[model samples]
Target: MTDLDAALSDINASAEEDVYVPFEAPEQSELDQKINQYFEGVVVRKDLVKAVRGNAVVPGYVLEYLLGQYAASDDEATIQEGIDTVRSILAEHYVHRNMHMAVKSLIREKGRFRVIDRVTVSLNEKDDVYEASFENLQITKVVIDPDTVKANEKLLVGGVWCICDIEYVHNDSPGSVPWQLGSLKAIQIAGVDFDSYYQGRRSFSTDEWIDLLVQSIGLNPEQFTSRGKLIALTRLVPFVERNYNLVELGPKGTGKSHTFSEFSPNGALISGGEVTVAKLFVNNASGKIGLVGYWDCVAFDEFAANRKTDQNLVNIMKNYMANKVFNRGNIQLGAEASMAFIGNTSHTVPHMLKNSDLFDELPDSYRDSAWLDRIHHYIPGWEVSPIRSEMFSDGYGFVVDYLAEVLRSKRSEDFSDKYKAYFTLDSTVSTRDQDGIRKTFSGLMKLIHPNGEATEDEVRDLLEYSIEGRKRVKDQILRIDATMRDSPVRFRYSDQAGTWHEVTTVEERQYPQLYPRSWNAEAADASGSDLETYAPPIVNPDAASSRSVRSVAPPLPIVPQGGGAAVIPDDDEPLFEGIRDFKAGQKGVSYENLLLPYLVGATKIQIIDPYVRAWHQGRNLGDLIGLLALAKDPADEIEVTLVTGETDKPHQKHDQLLMLKSLKDAADAVGVVLRISLDNAKHDRSIATDQGWRILLGKGLDIWEKPSNPIADARQEFRQIKSDTTFTYARIPVS
Candidate 1:
């Protein structure tokens, strides 16, 4: 057989084997069933992307668009047929750069041939015609008509993935091109019915819909917390919100550039991190527009520190990012493209907050206050977990091309004022700060609740999340440029009942010793003692439980414009009576930092949480017992009792008891007595001690989500908080 024929045979055999695997299939989940029921023709199994994508290097959206046409079904036979069809189509038509010569020869032999490739158009003013360039076919200056360029204008800016037909003729004449473009089709959904999409969205609950969107992005929502899901969805804001400016910096391997590059065809990812003014904004010399005129989002990838950039480009960017308009040759032009900058961070968050600012990794040109102030939100990318093979979902989700079209349609709707009915920002927040929060909140609302409906509590959650994102940008600016600290900004909000709540970044709360209360020069110059330099001390668990220590001063309350009470931590006295609230997704919290202070001086303790039957919950009970073992003297024995509920199922109850019995034996080896009591009616979760302290637990031992990595999860402080809880302390009744 010929070499080309042999290659095709090997690909066919591999495709057949990869299409199906022999295994016991799990039962369909409720959400997956609902997805297929409601959006049957627009959903497909997410795992099918990898199975069918053997060597075809194309954007995910392109492949999904094809899959949705042939394989959007739950039936195994239908799915296999669709996969085989897609693989055959790719094998016959998709152009590989290395095999371009073969494809070109085939076109010449057949007089006309069809292939899938990325096509870009450029205006040849000298020739007074438009010429096309095929990326993988390695052909340039193929004669293309002006009407085709006008119909698909995105071809002029950063190119578009397309299926095009080429006609070639043998020509011996001098100075003549033989390549001809017959037709072209971009690989995207042509149109979507907005009314139908809006009505379909009402079929699912908010949580279910959010999970659908997360799965559409190819992530398993079961593995992420609510906050982590939000962080992942925030990357789509630039697509749905017009003229939005966002910045995200964190460690590598977090998939920061994946959405912009592969999620949507309307977004363009500039991998070089630097571009000339002519290509990005406008070309004054040629009187042509740039990427902003064609794409919905222009993302800069690998944008790090020390890259030289033109001052004129930065100036034009600041104006366009702020006002959504730019000046070119005395003419004003406006477009709806959003801006995003994503890069890697060399230092940890604490290290940056202590010695430098978070924006220290950005180029000096972008580090200007005026430029930075235009950013609407700063995603704490450190909170995002790195992408793993297991993180991808195998369940059904919407074909991304359809979802992209839906988001593009949503860009025209505005929901910025939806939060005003529930809460109000503090007067100390500047106009720019308010705009940032409003834009971020508006985008998230559209993504989560497209029906323009949300409860007061739900609106409050989005509002606080929005404020925290913008506050991270503003707080780092205070550290980057001291001159901007003259006008201090306080990030606080007031509820309808006049209760004030201050929003703080998680890193600020985690490392209070590194963060300052005030960023002004006078505060820093006054005394080094103003900011505590010591970390949270690890007290010897072998010491007696009755040890005493000096108490530190408490933080001040955040009063609103209208005088109102706010909660504060009571660190001034021993045996304090107050509640400390932790936000969701906050890290660096643990049993030692949270409970050890109050657990001191207690010889006997009772954990009243009733949900300690699962393996993770049993691990939590063991951790508490281990804490007691550390707080007491090595020779002394402290009695610890756990009151939990028993399962109704026979096998589950048997396993729960076996796990607890094993934990009890491990506790006895450390000089602590472990006792378990099972009650079917136990509900309230709390920890009571014989030393006049009753600590309320909001989420019991299940405050944290399941861990992803062993090394990080081994330490409590490194785990992300899955739920928000308040630990209220009060004196026992002494009955």
Candidate 2:
């Protein structure tokens, strides 16, 4: 076995003993007791599929079902035996469609045999019995009992891929056929006692419960930060609620459809093929219900690529997605299946919003404003990074089948009204708008707080997330449809007797050009004169803006310093803590980010770097002056002294003079004095200010890599680091 295979097999082993594990295990604590008590026999650890799934190209649920049958015990030896048993079963009994004759002969010889295959049941009105058909096996007209047919109505409409026993008997009587069902089992959860499940859920904290749910879906939640965790969990909304419609579009390899397709049996993940009205809604001539009537969730994978889509289908979809009811002939029909559309976008978030909108990724046929408005939530898939092996969980989580049942059982409960107790949303839009927010909120609550024991803060977090998700759809709809520009949907809410709180979508905050004239747009820019005049309305940057330290710099705390446009009351005031470290490939790094915070009130500043001698290096020095230009403090006559080693080249003196001349011109334009001197002995690099803050740099002014020309490609404000390097920043008190 490979290292990953060995590590996966040893997931149940003690952490110390299992040195091959690539990721950290979650803190089990008291939760393990609940995991063992209620979930022992019914569920299996999700990672076991990786342990035993070697060459078999089967779905995650397939491997999980086998593991559930064998390794459902807690004992190490028993689990190991069960793993081996499951592996053996897949190798021997699992049908290979390519070798159909061999499997058919085995079934005929054995009289009855179990095999994994897709089975769809149909009602025979003339015979008054249900007949089962196997897609891969090419078998049809096999009689299934009426009781089994009634118990699993999902089989009658959309064919379910299942594992069942196939029996063959040779009848002596004329016109008698012999293929019959010995037993049958649907791929999804048979049933779940939610009371017991809720009792078990109350054992863990909100964060712990959230992590457990993420792990149950086969992800290591710790790898994702809080925003990332929220984004990943939003994909599960469709499975937990009825008639929900969600869209996720971004770069590829983000596991956008993994949750819908292979994770559960109740969901159908289809490709972006030509969608006909009959295949999706109903076959009018045959009077058979389509996928919407049977499956709990139907996801359209690569949704943007369906160029040949019929306009009729889009029109029908728009109506059905909004009302959750459609007509087949004259018969009115309603179904509860949720809809998920996952696709890859060709343009970046900034690029799309500047020219068009995020919805531009879809083909023109399906980009109708009416069709787009029907969607309730728009998950920001661009925020999610591509899946890596380290993101896989090696901890205990529920088997996919078991979790599917739990989420489906939660559909009956509505948590939409639960938010009304703590907060009130603006009644600005039509019922459709309110329904969109409430359903998204309900779905998120069902996913994260199925037990209904969430704290007020936790509830608020989910509420904001739900609102932001729905806000993305609404904002984009306004861009697509001219009528929606005047729509009365306010992205604001209020707490009990508190001021109204407005929310902003992630992309809207990241690329403000899309929403150029927001109510708080001017307040977002916190630099120079703007900072002196206005303070940001929201304390938390994420409320409307993105990360607290993103493109929009926070107002520099004006304290007493000798010189600079900024001011403070007194020098005796205690200095507040200010320090930041940046990883490579990090964007939004500039001098305004590194030095501006420390040099706010300094009359004199020192720049020391040994290698600021080459032309590109001098250009970096010039860029530093440009940052000062952006900080244009006409009131403060600041003096900047550059101390660096001489360039050892023959014309070093001439080069140094020319570089200093350029720096002088740039600084003088910004109302500052620039001075330069050579120090051959200088080794370390740092910037010290008269205000008593030392900003140390491991790589000095050359912390960034060379940008290949055109400037826009390497603009550090939006550019990612191209190489691996280290830098440290610290502020020391001048005593």
Candidate 3:
């Protein structure tokens, strides 16, 4: 048998006998193996268990007790047996929808059996009187006297988990009856110590831990796509970072809410439009604590597009995000709980960038500069496509509960300095900008390159991407309000002798067809181009003094081309000659189809997209790399470099270098190279022949769909390959 088959067979054999012997088995006992097998690879159904067990909202152990039943073994018979046992336990002991009836039945049938329930109780120890309140069964204000019970004697009250008090009644009867009693153990259930659990499981590597989690959830890790793996990894970030505020705004049906609602005990999901200041922080009247106080991470589901939020609350949230301190009745308190906000966007990326920005649709309160500035990162929700059923994995992973705790313990460390040695940010950046950029940089750095050993280019790329992400937020604000000044966080050079340049956004450099102002209007207009005239309006300095009516220029006419821009069809296309020969000049297949299949395994790909040195091309290069990553295998190694002209900013080169470094590191983890080469050549777009076997043409690295409102679907149906675009492929003969 093959090595993989042998391994699988051994694993199956061990599992058949109710034992699991990992390749690197520790000194674990048979029971440990059984417990691991039971909990590993099973996703706990939190809502179902919560619905069944009333009165007490017990922690995850209760649900784990259930998952352990359904996911005990790989064997169907063994798993069925475990499920039967679990079902019996729940049916016999757990309170149901009719909690009062269920509790009553339990008390009558079992007589004195112990039960689990949430109870709120008040104690007057000195007076020997106590009052108890139950939530699920609706029992409230039940008074009990302690004097009737023996001093310091513990009694199981009502066969339920509780702390109570009892007192003797002076009556002319055969025996003294209990007059008063109190209980305190209402919230206490059989909770596994989280710290101990995490500590015990900390020895496993991240991959191993992730595998364990996937296995515990009963999903194989190998079946998941790269993006799927990333989505899964994101779930663990909350657990890894203390107070790690994460926002994943992606397409619908990506299972964004699954981890928060069903994965672990430490997480809670608050539905959209249901969050209030009191619920998030502290309630004044009842002195009841909020979600932040109770849960390690509070995820706001469907958090986007709420227009009716309170301004005061938004302001308070800004403070909380910036300082981690929120005010409660003139008191500022700190919390280590992380926050997550998820929402869906109605518009596509290109449309959003063209007309507004990612944050444009947000409510005015949330749109405040201070509030937006405090958000550490803004995930490109549109880029994360809807999850397909096929994306789930079949490999092993850690239980969600175990993974969450690992993330929690890892938050104290920072991995930012690993990149600091090779590169540095431009000095012109502000603290707010720096904070936004650095927080994102640091968070991602912590996530992947936690040891801070990332190369110079790796650090540079991440910094640039982080800066660009934050810029996407800032740029939209500008479109919404022209009064907002441009941010000074330019990606410039730190060295005395600058060798590189910067590109702030994709619109600034490439897609001159979209940005008329940046386009060379003379050249474009001379080609019988339908390009609109984009002359800057001359402002009359004295108009304000006399209130004179200024003459307005007539609207520029749009001359539409017959079939878009003219293209000179090549008779001798040497670039694609090699590809045509390999495919035997297949008539029906386009260049994209011919070349894309071979490009899938490439380790590094280079694209040369240059504009004015520091303004646009850098971003174009970065975006190209991102696209290549989408097409390539997640584990395949690759790198991309952009060769462009020098820019005017003294620090632009440094910023570009740093950006490249960050990208390199991110790519390295996922198997890609990110780099930049400076060249002053004016007109050239060619993919390096040495990096791989094929080259792309027609905007080389800048191919993008036309901007559309409400964003067109990303599926292959709506978008077709550019017919005029040229591509070349050549086989690099094996040495």
- Among these predictions, the greatest lDDT belongs to 1
Error of 2 at 34 (Å): 5.8
RMSD of 2: 15.4
What TM-score does prediction 1 earn? Answer: 0.71
Report lDDT (CA) for all predictions. Answer: 0.80, 0.71, 0.48
Lowest summed lDDT window (length 10), candidate 3: 549-558
TM for every model, in the order presented, reads 0.71, 0.67, 0.52
Runs with alpha carbons beyond 4 Å of true place in candidate 3: 1-62, 65-83, 98-100, 112-228, 242-244, 444-469, 481-483, 491-735
Model 1 CA deviation exceeding 4 Å by range: 1-26, 520-735
Model 3 clash tally? 88
The better-scoring model by lDDT among 1 and 3 is: 1
Task: Looking at model 1, report the run of 10 residues with the lowest lDDT sum.
Answer: 544-553
Which one wins by TM-score: 2 or 3?
A: 2
Could you give me the TM-score of model 2 versus the true structure?
0.67
Rank order (by lDDT, best first) = 1, 2, 3
Predicted candidate 2 versus true structure: per-residue lDDT over 69-163, tens digit per residue: 78876666777788778777777766667866788888899999988777889877887788998876777888999898887887886577677
Give me the overall lDDT of model 1: 0.80
Compose the digit string of candidate 3's lDDT tens values, residues 1-735: 112224334544543452222222124334334435544444332223323333334444445545444543444455445545555555555444466665654444544444344444445455455555554544544464454222212221212233332222335656333232333332222334544544434444555544555544434455765444544555555655556556666555556776676555566677768878887877776554566765567788888856678776777677777787877777778876777778866544433444545675676677676676666556655444344334443333343454454445557776545445655667766676666666666666655454454556667766676666565555444445545544333544352245544536544343243333213234345333322422222222222122122212121111223435423323222223332211222123322333333444445556555542442334444444544555543323455555554444655644544444444444433334444555556356656534345454434543334323332222211233333454454545434
Q: Which stretches of candidate 2 lie over 4 Å from their true place?
A: 1-34, 123-129, 170-178, 517-735
